[model samples]
Target: MFLDPLATPGFKRTLFNAIVAPRPIGWISTINAHGQTNLAPFSHFNLVSTAPAVVMFSCNTPADRAEKDTIANVRSTGEFVTNLVTWELREAMNLSSFNAPYGVDEFELAGLEKAPSLKVRPPRVKASPASMECKVLRIIEIEPIVEGDTTSHVVLGRVVGVHLDERLVDAHGHFDTLRAEPLTRLDGDRYAISGRTDMLGRPSPRRD
Candidate 1:
């Protein structure tokens, strides 16, 4: 079926996320100036560049129309940790996404352990298989594409430190994606895991 977001009067913001298929969950952890910690998942996240090791996640305005704690904390502290979510921690990750108050600590609410990060004030999820400690490059407020679009902010961070569970790595140093079983974001309350695995090589260069 053909759908035109701009033309449709009842187009949903979720349609964009749903059409994009499974997206990696950026289980971000951040701390405010007063040491208040927050954790939230953002599906609009990905590695933007490799040379400088930068990653980005987009946070949308909530129903309350107030600034989200995650965005405010990241702006205040200039740091955050992207904790990789796996099937094992799915429930905890979901629990942390609740619309808690500003000072509420989601880690404590989720009953998850927080491990000190090496290069950032924000702690990492101890149960996560991997985490990227990042310094905030910038936070850009996204302009509305259509008139009624809610406010959104894109947070870009430069990866300053990384943590990988040694148990998930092989002797050759390749981290097993299948073993990690990373959780992915889906439409509504649905979620997915990296269940199957395969590889495909790039085509050879065409010779004249």
Candidate 2:
């Protein structure tokens, strides 16, 4: 079937959102300059670079709230932490996603322990297998195509510190992905866990 994005979908935004499937969830935590803590989950997040250990996440304006606490806190203090969610912490992580007030303590609400970060004011999720403390490098506002419509603000942070649970690591100091059993978001309310698979290198060049 052939259809123009503007015509067939009726709403181009919803169509585009669904096409981008199963993005990795970033359970972000941050603290404001005033010492108020905030936690939220974002799917529009990924590692952008490795040289300086950069990660980026986008936070959209909340429907009911005037501003997103994650964005505000990051802008205020220039620091945040990204906690890797595993299958075991899925329910707790989801609780953190609630759109509560700015002063609300998500860690307490979700019943997750807060592990003090080495360099950042925001604490990391102790139950999480891995977490990265980051300092904000940049915050870019994604301008909307039309006026009066504001797009999500993309926050890029440099990972300055890392925390890992020894149980999830091997004796060789390598992260055991299988043992981690990381949880990931699927379409809509669906979710998935990492599966066991064989490693296959790229095919070699064929000889004439």
Candidate 3:
């Protein structure tokens, strides 16, 4: 079956998300200029580069046409934190995804405790196994091609500070992802855990 995403009648965007199955969730935390904290989850989030330790997450404008608190906070303060969601904190992470009003503290709403970041103003989730304190590199506005399509803001950040629980780190200083039991997002209402991870090595290049 052939499907033209540009011409699809309904759920095209959702279909796109499902096609990109099992995306990592960036549980983002940010602070507004007035020092209000915001926490939210974005499945369209990933590490884009390792040289400078950069990560990015995208935020879309809702039907109300108001900027999300995370986006607004990032723009306001130029910093944000990426918190790793673990199996034990799955319910708290889900609870924080609620569409609460601006200035509403999702940390309190989700019953999660906040830990002060070392280099950034935003606080990290105390329960998270790892967190990245980042400075905003840029925010790219994704313009819509067709009418009625919403705009999305892609926020890029450079890792300035990192917090990792020693329990998840090995003697070699490598992160034990399975031990951390990180959580990921599947299409709609579905989620995945990384407890049973598989290791694969890249093949050596063949000489011509």
Which regions in candidate 1 have their CA more than 4 angstroms from the true location?
A: none
Per-prediction CA RMSD (Å): 1.5, 2.1, 1.5
Q: Which stretches of candidate 2 lie over 4 Å from their true place?
A: 146-150, 206-208
Q: What is the C-alpha lDDT of each candidate?
A: 0.91, 0.85, 0.92
RMSD of 3: 1.5
Candidate 1 lDDT over 1-208, as tens digits, reads 7778889768786887788979999999999999888899888899999999999999778878577888888888899999999999999999999888789999999999999999999999999999999999999998778777778999999999999999999999998888899999888888999666678899999999
What C-alpha lDDT does candidate 1 achieve relative to the native structure?
0.91
Clash counts for the predictions, in order: 0, 0, 0
Alpha-carbon shift of residue 107 in model 2 (angstroms) = 0.5
lDDT of 2 by residue, 55-122 (tens): 99997776766569999898889999999988888899889988788889999999988889999899
Identify the runs in model 3 with alpha carbons over 4 angstroms from their true place.
none
- lDDT at 30 for candidate 1? 93
Residue-level lDDT tens digits of model 3 in 1-208: 8878778677466877888978899999999988889899999999999998999999789875478889989988999999999888989999999999888999999999999999999999999989999999999999988887889999999999999999888899999887888898888889988645576999999999
